[model samples]
Target: MYRTWRFATGCNDACAIDDYRDICPVFFFGGIHSKKGFFMGIVRKPSVTPPSSRSPVDATPSRTRPGSATFGDGPAVKIFRPDTDQAQVEVPRQSAAADSMITVSSMPSAQILPMHPMAGSLARYSLRAPANLPAANALGLRVFKSRNYVDIAPGEIVLVRETGTAGEYRAALVSELVALGPVLFYHPLSKTWTLERPHPLPEPGKVIDIDIDQLVRKVRKEHAQKHRVHTGNDDSFEYSAAQEGALVARGLKQFPPEQAAIIRSELQAVESIFADAGHAIGQNYKDADAVYESFFGVDHHAVAQRFADSVARGQALSSEYQGTWGDEKFVGVDADSNSAAWMYKRDFHGRFFINRKYMQRGVLSISLGHEMLHTNRIDRFQTIGPNAADYFYLDSRLGRLLNWDTLADYDVPERSVSDAIMRGGLTVEYLNAFTNDHDNFLFGVSDYLGIGDDLPLQTAVDLFNANPSLRAHLAVNNADSLVYAAKSMQTLHQSKTEYAWLDSLIDD
Candidate 1:
């Protein structure tokens, strides 16, 4: 039966072969014997249990019914079936049953699992769990998942959109797990994040700190408004108007009504002269004042006031002239004491001495006016150096009364004359020639005077007759050259003349 069972079950075992061994005991009808001639009546198959069934099968009883030594223990007990070729084995049913009971008892009291520190660090950045992961593992990564992304591992940094803000914020994943609710928390002061702590946004209507770029743009816009350059065509006229307004404002504030009225009238008359003459005054005149202070080391206004007083006395004493000198004398003093005055007389000899005090107003004007007639007569004279002989002939007193028209058959273009006067180049000879007047001594002195040599007499006449447009262009170019020369002269004068004169003038 064991051999049959082995064949049916596909089991190979040494016991199965031994069942057919010739030396093995065999039972026949109830007796057993060995092939070696030993005889025994006992025959039995091992009592065994089938794995599939719980029942145990009884061994065949010994063939000898009465008295074979009953092998109760059997030859050698085996735990496995001998008929099978498989190795010996023990069943684990007892141990497995014990384990199952223990597992059931341990279940209901399970502790909460602590998260990894790495996971906590990653919670700073609002990253999501991987897509392939189960829903339970993906809980903390909702912010990243909503964006269709996955969580960054710890020690990684990511740029993320700041919550409730338009711009992005940077965050570092310092840990892999977080226990608290996942949310992006920014610390502005340290520029970091905290998994344990979070900050709240500002309340409604509260002011927040401005971004640097916004502040810069705002400041640039304000600066553009404040400092935009004036591009209107009226700029030149506007500057003149401002100067007049300044004078009027000063007069109104400082003077009584009657005095202010007189001052305003005087200013109006002077401005009329400037406008009719096409003379660039105002700013140029004030700049001259600064140069005067620098050059003479004295207040230019004080000098001008002193000069004005002298001029007033000269005009009052003289009765031959009837026309108003106006405030020309005052304005002249201020302008001439400055840089324009230097430019005007730069080519003239003894300009320093001639310009000092009120010499131009007193002696020079008187002398030049008389010489103009003589130059008109001969058409040869020039206005430079001394002209005492011509003055004697004309008699200085009557000479002042004779307007150029009476002496010569021409009218002086008043605007051109005024420009020349304001520019300081309007010599008596040039003026007489410009008006198409005749003068004998003018022709005789034209070549003798050094002025004609420095600036040729013909050239001077041409420049004098130039139209306003051409004259303005020339004036600009001349002004630049004049400034350059004046600076050079100033430097030379300081190093040589002023220093040397100071030593002699000041007490040791």
Candidate 2:
């Protein structure tokens, strides 16, 4: 009993092989004569570790919980104790076989963050359980059972990658290993997948609380604008179901009914989300806002209020909307603005919102630059309100919002016949101007709405093609340079911009 080491709990026996027990269990070693018969090695004399050789594991008391840095079927994590900053323990991976050689390392557990602290977005998406069990298994995590492939408990995290054949970039879900301590992940810089402690999502600290109040001020500035037309000049523009139908009828004819139905449902959903307030998502926004909200649970109204407030302030103050950046202006990185660390699950949450395959902020801003030129779009053709002070304010508003980052001090392109191609023709001026005219007409809806013969052309693809430099920033394999899927956000302004209206007016 003198050689036997007991825990602080007082069990007085060292651990034995074949002991499948919880933490704080006794562990001791001996040779030749031990009963329960673990470690049948070649009989050498006196190889047992003596009492003076008590390892740290033997000295420490048991502190096991599900969240304990070391657990099962995973790595032995070297954890930083919550109470102190000191590095405390390294629980080695246990083996059931007594003779099995155990390989131990000093790696810590991985940090599992579905909502990243830095990125103001949900980085990892939780897959719908059991329904996606096989998909989860395909990414290499042994999450499914043998008999029916039932999903394991505890939600699984997945990274989205594009996997379809060339030209058609579809999203594919891959398994991501997340843990409380350092775990394995594919590190982008080194070009190797290695064991790394994942970045834990931080709490929504003081920085964000301050930023939210600042943004609220910005939104208030937006609420004072005169250019918005949704509810104004309204007796003539009450919501019209017939007008909405005629607007998309021809475009609808091109798509299969099933596909068209989904678009219509999404559009109606947009109307539901935005129509009541003067902020109704007009044709310019289309199904983009709805799809964006569905994909990331983004509060469109909140973001829009910010953008609108900024636009209003820009229109009223200077000649255009300007970003809240630069000397005394730089708003800092988007991720650090309001971590709502509680909200983002991954590191690249904001990246997806600013740039994605669907209608993303980049494409919309580019299109806005062109659309702002038409008096109908900017002035709202109202009998009640007056025209804007100048086109400079409109261009600058968009530039501050999307451009100045790229097409420096650029002019908003002048409207012309060629402008018909901009945003697949989904300009609000056109929508509001012709709603009464086209209420009964079903023809030319595709060209009129600015969508291609292939329904509404994927805006991201168009922007992606324009900005070839975007291919490298995303951490996914690009399908011939167009982003099918990516993990990081490349600045939209970094790409070369081609203004359709500018070219048209120049040609004329």
TM-score of each: 0.15, 0.16
Which of the numbered candidates is closest to the native, going by highest TM-score? Answer: 2
lDDT, candidate 1, 1-508, per-residue tens: 1100101121122122222110111111111100010111123222221112212222221122224432221222111111111111122233765876654222121112234454453433343222233221222222423221223343222323333344323242222111111334444444444443434456889957656666897886697468632222123322322321221221122334553344335334322322221111111333444333322223234333222221222222121111232111111111122111110111111111111222222223222122111111111111111111110011111222223223221122222222222232334443331112112122223322334323444455344333333222222212111122123223333344347677677756
Please report the TM-score between candidate 2 and the true structure.
Answer: 0.16
Q: Report, for every candidate in turn, its global Cα lDDT versus the true structure.
A: 0.25, 0.22
In model 2, the runs with Cα more than 4 Å from the true position are 1-120, 127-154, 159-161, 164-508
Clashes, model 1: 33
Q: Which candidate has the top score in lDDT?
A: 1
Model 2, 1-508: lDDT tens digits are: 0011112222222232111111111111221110111011111112122112222232222312223211122223221111111111223345778436765454442233454332222232222232223333332333332211111124433323222233211111122121111123433333222233223334866233245556886875587355432222222111111111121221233334654344334333322221211122221234334322321123333333323222222222112112121011101111211110010101111110110112222223222221121111122111110111110111111122221123322121211111121212223332221111111111123223444333222343333224222211210110101110000001111111235467578899
In candidate 1, stretches whose alpha carbon ends up further than 4 angstroms from where it belongs are 1-252, 267-508
Q: How far is candidate 1 from the true structure (C-alpha RMSD, Å)?
A: 63.6
